[model samples]
Target: MSQNWKFFKESVRHFWQVGSLVQSSRYLVDSLLADVDFAESRLIVEFGAGNGCVTRELLRRMRPDARLFSFELSQVFHEEISSIAARDPRLTAVHGCAMLAAQMFAAQSVDCVVSGLPMGNFGKCAKLGVLSTVHAVLKPGGHFSQFQYSLLDYRLMKRHFPAVRLGYTPLNFPPAFVYNCVSA
Candidate 1:
């Protein structure tokens, strides 16, 4: 099946969660990952692995022994990404919510977290839970990158991460705001 079709179908079925009708573009991916140091990262987590665009990029840059766990709440998206994960030993696909990150990974165990989750769509409590889980799993100096079409979650991100750097990319389907954050 064509990847684009899959994205369209999933987006129609889960618009509020998926956020877009297509996968992220290279420009948006690059912008979101501008500050990630993949060379030294060993344990990484991806919040939403919709069609594996960013997952492929992360795998390309990550070391041979590095492990990447990708979470997707939509069963369809999970199945799609799981197929991609099957081809790479370093990648693991989890069909669950990002809020379970703290339960899945030990405190300060993750080197980085790249999120495709729509934080702006989440309620305040859900937002706080997910952000807190991200903070709990990330190492003291680790990074978390999240991209959204709006700055609706800017203050929410700042509340959890001590340092937050914002970047914009107009090349995507809808211009995106990339937040590069560091855990204190």
Candidate 2:
């Protein structure tokens, strides 16, 4: 399909940032959102919207009034997400870095932050900056769900979040570990 092609091409071009050559499997997306209460979460932020697979799923599940700000650094992926945002009033596709989340939104304004970023590929400063920004925007008790090919940034996440729960999904392109961390 066209989706697969775009994902593959983009991944090949930006492997370190995009992470995978295929879009996330439905199983992986479900596992990442399993603990999130979409109905109760009014404001959501998605880091590394990539090809918009997870963004579409979040739009489908979130409440009518819920708002989704999907941040994508890649131009191709950002355009893809922007097109989807054009059709969905609730989605705000942002072409920027995840580390700037705090600048884009008010502190304690987000109910949750979901990410498909390749944290393992990020340098320590980038990892910490993004995590801290995510934490700053999230409301108390808000959740941050991120999936990675490995537990590369597990310790970093634990340092920023008060509680971090880990899970795994074997049905993805490459099986992934999902971290569900809650802001204190």
Candidate 2 Cα outliers beyond 4 Å, as residue runs:
none
lDDT of 2 by residue, 1-184 (tens): 5999989998999888887889999999998898788879999999999999899999999999999999999999999999999999999999988888899888899999999888888888888788888878999999899998887878877888789899899999899999999899
List lDDT for all candidates, in order: 0.91, 0.91
TM-scores for every predicted model: 0.97, 0.96
RMSD of 1: 1.0
Cα lDDT tens digits for candidate 1, 1-184: 8988989998999899898988999999998788988888999999988888999999998999999999999998888889988899899999999888899999999999999988878888888888889888999999999999999988878887899999999999988999999999
Weakest 10 consecutive residues, lDDT, candidate 2? 151-160
Model 1 TM-score relative to the real fold: 0.97
RMSD of 2: 1.1
Instruction: Score residue 135 of candidate 2 by CA lDDT.
Output: 73
